[model samples]
Target: MNLTAPARRARRAALLVPALLGAAVVAFLAQRPLGGHRAGWNGWVGTVNGIVFLAAAALPVAVLAVWALARRRRAAGAEPGWARRSALAEVGTLYGTAPWVWMILLPGVDPGGPRRRVNLVPLHDVAEIVAAGPPATAAAQIVGNMLVFAALGFLLPVRFAAFASVWRVLALGAACSVLVEAAQYALRLDRVSSVDDVLLNAGGAALAALAARRWWRRA
Candidate 1:
């Protein structure tokens, strides 16, 4: 289905406008200093916020750089479509993933505290969050956990045939989540190592892969 020139321009604008607005928001947030001194839970929260902002601010530049590299590859006789898709997959995986990983690895308020928290029972932590009320925080926790691997799931299949299935994406997400949880435990980050997190992360990846199934099919 070919779009008329005006329709194509309109579609581009529709995508570009929101992206520009988002970049502006990220740039604004990145300029703000981390709140409070570097100590305690509040400090940790502030540091995470700062890191998130910085990552968001840098995302556009990273995307552009990847695009430029892909363009160069295309000029050097690489297939244009493959080059673009590969660049997007690479950048999306890194940009969407690294900040969350950093936040996860950052030591909690009591990094060297007496005990490292671990939740082996599946859904225990998730149940607690849901029952705790304050819908916003619960939603954020659930959604954020899901989004942690969503980009990887969505784009991995698009770039590689080996991961062109929802099950593979789910397994990949679970494996990565396990590694992160293990790091948190081994490093005594004071964060809970929860089976529920792995479940949610894998579920998110599977769902995202489902959404991208058409693209992956073409890939």
Candidate 2:
């Protein structure tokens, strides 16, 4: 029998978003090192830059996941709407910023790493040029971060013009960054809270919001 509207939407998220996100993850891993100066393996796209690119690319998947699941939740079935909760979890709260969490590699302390009161290094304070690279790398990382959230903002189901303002979303995003940094610092988990990350993240959000604005207008 044909299901209800909610069922179709839930199925859509489960089918479409996951398929897209899975493909992306596969492509990203296939393009390993995703950053820089890495030798190619099996002709896959290897480089640190890939990492930066993947970080941003994941944004669409996250958005789709949230919307799809949110839609699914609106259509409940057995199991207390497990489908909806699952979708909510996939996109809600910390999805956009998870990449940064992974980047920090705070699994534990490095005995040789420097001790810091907080990891909050101001975004501008971070040198655009590191021993391994130039501003492009730094810029990429920042862009990725913002795009992640901006895509999130777009998919967040908040379709109102005023509520969807870039300034508001960016502000909310920056506050989120601050809360994350504070948590890291307060826990003394050895994660440095750099103010620079906050700046880059906010900038990323703004840029994404701008992009979203354009796309929205077009749509």
Candidate 3:
């Protein structure tokens, strides 16, 4: 008897979660209080944001160039297969989300000093922002939160057959949001951790995933 692909995946799932968690832990230790605001960097460009932005900008150009060259070499042969497309999607996914992740991970600096703030109640802070009559900031924040994971929501289903559902996107987005919020709270980044942020982020990802539903891979 041979194990099916899904069975193989399920077997590996046992190790995948722990491995991912371990990597996340290591990344948390290496980046925060060390590579973040606590470090000796003096400007935004010198920070993770600038570094990731440059990398993201360069990734597609490099990947596509190689892809093009390979296609050219096989001009009289079959086109590149799932391996190439999947690789592009994987690399692009990382490149697309790097900036947002970098921004979220960047340590916040309190203009006055460091302080921990928390907003546990849902919709409370969002309502205040809306009620204050500065609709622009509120609107931007809501949309920005959604856009943080928009690329992942839009791209994941296009490549991976398993993530081709609205619910999966929502779950993935929520999980990612929780991690980011936890990191902010844990790192004492002088930022308020809010439940509303998670809602908006997850909602945005779900909506974007729906928009890309047409391109979702059929299982």
Candidate 4:
């Protein structure tokens, strides 16, 4: 049966609600726990308190921005759906992904040690980390790397037509990962730049994009 525009929109929104929730759950599972034994490892990614405060502070600004955009669209006799969604997605994208970027940019402490490390061979570092590191540390590193760009992957297609395809999301994630890795190397942040990071990050982006495939903006 054919559905009217509003009905179709509502149905799509209904589907999106669950997909978004699943994305949140997946992201949550990929991170270090918020409290308990490992809580002190609260590096940038683990800094739940700071990230929550930032997100909370940004919410009102996003809401007001969306309201203003909707008012402009209504003044121009246009449907506010696109305007509202665009505004929300734009704000959400920045708000959700900024913490990851901040985390990546934070310098590791190594006052008396070598400044930088690099691993060019694909899968080499990944295998080593998995084998040599504690199980919990290895899991946290792998999952954290994957989730670095997962929010970008999940939200980009919903906001922009160009990112609707899985490959685009993959490429975007890889490129962004390269930038972050490069920065780490250049700044001598005592971090290892690894090919495995690019691989897992791109994989995460692809997986997240797939989750939002139904809601992707069409050309």
Q: Pick the candidate with the highest TM-score.
A: 1
Give all TM-scores, in the order shown: 0.86, 0.52, 0.66, 0.70
lDDT score, residue 187, model 4? Answer: 77
Kindly give the number of clashing pairs for every candidate. Answer: 0, 25, 0, 0
Put down candidate 2 lDDT per residue, 1-219, tens digits, no spaces: 999989977987787767666757765664555333344441222233444455556667667776676666667553535455546534644565555544443423542345545544454446643434677886666565555455455533233345357777678668766776676665566655677767766666666666656433221
lDDT, candidate 4, 2-121, per-residue tens:
999999879967976675566455545544345444555553244655455445445556656766876787788776677777666776677667777777766677623666788999
- The sequence of per-residue lDDT tens digits that candidate 3 reaches over residues 50-111 is 45434534643646664675565456454555544555556657766766766776666662
Question: Which of candidates 3 and 4 is the stronger one according to TM-score?
Answer: 4
Candidate 1 deviant stretches above 4 angstroms: 1-14, 30-46, 217-219
The reply for model 4, stretches above 4 Å from the true place, is 1-53, 74-77, 111-114, 133-137
Candidate 4 residue 12 Cα shift, in angstroms, is 15
Worst 10 residues of 4 by lDDT: 43-52
Candidate scoring better on TM-score of 2 and 4: 4
Would you list the rank order by TM-score, best first?
Answer: 1, 4, 3, 2
* Model 4 per-residue lDDT at 8: 88
What overall lDDT goes with each candidate model?
Answer: 0.83, 0.57, 0.72, 0.77
> Residue 175 of candidate 3: its Cα lDDT?
92
RMSD of each: 3.4, 8.9, 13.4, 5.9
Which of the numbered candidates is closest to the native, going by highest lDDT? 1
User: Once model 2 is optimally superposed onto the true structure by TM-score, how far is the C-alpha of residue 215 displaced, in angstroms?
Assistant: 6.5
Error of 3 at 93 (Å): 1.6
